[model samples]
Target: MKYALKRIFMLVLTMVIVSFLTFLAFELISGDPAEAMLGTEATPERLAALREELGLNRPFLVRYASWLAGFVSGDLGVSLRYRQPVWDLIAPKLEITLCLCLASFVLITAVSIPLAIWSYRWTGTVFEAVRTAFNQLCMAVPPFFTGILMTYLFGIVLRLFVPGDFPDLHTRFGEAMVHLFFAAVCLGIPRTAMTVRMMRSTVISEMQKAYVRTAISRGNDRHAVLTRHVLKNSLTSAITFLGQTMAELIGGSVVVEQVFGIPGLGRLLVYSISTRDYPVVQTVVVILAFWVVLAGTLADLINQQVDPRLRLGGAA
Candidate 1:
């Protein structure tokens, strides 16, 4: 209970800091929301009205306070670009982005873990050399590159799947699967390479520990030694990687979404930024920050369980 409470408090503190920084950063940027709304030829009266309408005429601190209050109450305000409630504009797109992130994560873990375990088992061989080469190549290629390659091959030349945008799963699961699978693969390839490398390193490190040596000395089989002693320890590092990946996924999805024309948060964010929609951008940044902090918190809690030194009581 105490640990959970501490986490919640820290989450709140982190959000407060994020909000303050976002506010300050946007304020420093050129172009006011009112000016963006009224245009350069506007009369002073129209400018004053626009400011009053958007509550921009208020003192900075007061405006921040009011906005924060509304945010806490689930009202993120209206977007100047979309002319709709920020949540209304964001919620539908968020679903798609969240699904994309989740799909990428699942695919990454599924492929990386087995390859990592394989790499650990078959260390120092031609197989290991091949794995190293493959991972290195994947690490070198960016997600956008992979996305484009997939689109060109499977989507364009072969005509195996649609090029961009997700399909309706409700009507046709098959087509939806094709779109999602391509997207997931594009996003997951680089992530899988990075994750596999980290997991393999962690597995190697854990296998060299005294506990693992003890298990091996007890006549335990390789499978038993790995499953019983090493997997959990290795996963701690993987979990941390996944959390950081979560943060990157939200931002990185922009490229993939745009390349494919997917209606996701990444595309929405791109649109908002291009139009200088301050409210939409600010709200999205805050939301992304919350997800990032939450992911970190989850990783910390899991790490505490796997590694006793991370616990508050420092249990062994």
Candidate 2:
């Protein structure tokens, strides 16, 4: 509880920093947004008027403070491109992106855990070698490229699903997931590979520990020792590593969404950034940052629970 509370405070602090940095970076961006939004050929009076209207003429600190205040109130201002409530523009797409990322995370976890156990069980066999090689290949390939390949094979050739035709969640929940499955595959494969490798390494390392050796000397069954002792102990590092992958998953979702033609947050972020839609971009960045930090905190809690030493105020 103490650790969780500490993490919660830190999350708030981290979010403030992220929000400030995001706002500042856009403030520093070259080119006058007001002038750019208006025609270059427009008169100076109109440009100045536009700048005042958009609050571009405000001091940097003042504008940032105001934005932060609005953020705290759950008002992210308006999208420059769409001229709509930033939240309204973001909410639906954020849901889609969250769904995609969540499905991918679940799939990766489901696949990697068993595969890791299998690899550990057959450590010296040809199966281990094959699994390692295949995972390495998957890890080497970028998600965007994999997404394209998946689209070609499944959507173009196999016709199992259309490349970018995601159905609305409300209208057809089942059909939407079906289309999302392919994109999730692209997002999950590399993560699955990474997790499997992390699990394998951690398991091997745990088996070499003094406690493990002591258990073996006591005539404990090797398989039972692995299951009852080592597996949970080894999973701490793997969980930490898996939590780190959320950043990559968010990034990959952007390119994968584009490749697969899903209108998720990633695609929205890219479009908003290209259009100099600062509110939209800032909102997305902060949301993603929050998600990553929250995931890290959850992973830490899980790790602590798995290893009592860690739970004891992280003595180890």
lDDT values for all models: 0.84, 0.85
Off by more than 4 A, model 1 = 158-160, 168-174, 313-316
lDDT score, residue 177, model 2?
Answer: 86
- Which pairs in model 2 have colliding backbones? none
lDDT of 2 by residue, 1-316 (tens): 7776776788899989998998888878737877667757989999999888889888999999999999889889888788899999999999899889989988998889888888888888888788878988999998889888888998899987777787898798887887788899899998899898889888888888999988888888988898888988878887888888765688779888999888899889888888877778888988988898888988888887777777665556
The parts of candidate 2 lying over 4 Å away from their true place are 217-219, 314-316
TM-scores, in order shown? 0.93, 0.93
Prediction 1 TM-score vs. true:
0.93
lDDT of 2 at 150: 87
Clashes of each: 0, 0
Candidate 1 residue-wise lDDT, 49-121, digit = tens: 8888888877989988988999999899999977899988998788778878888878887888988899888
lDDT of 1 at 309: 62
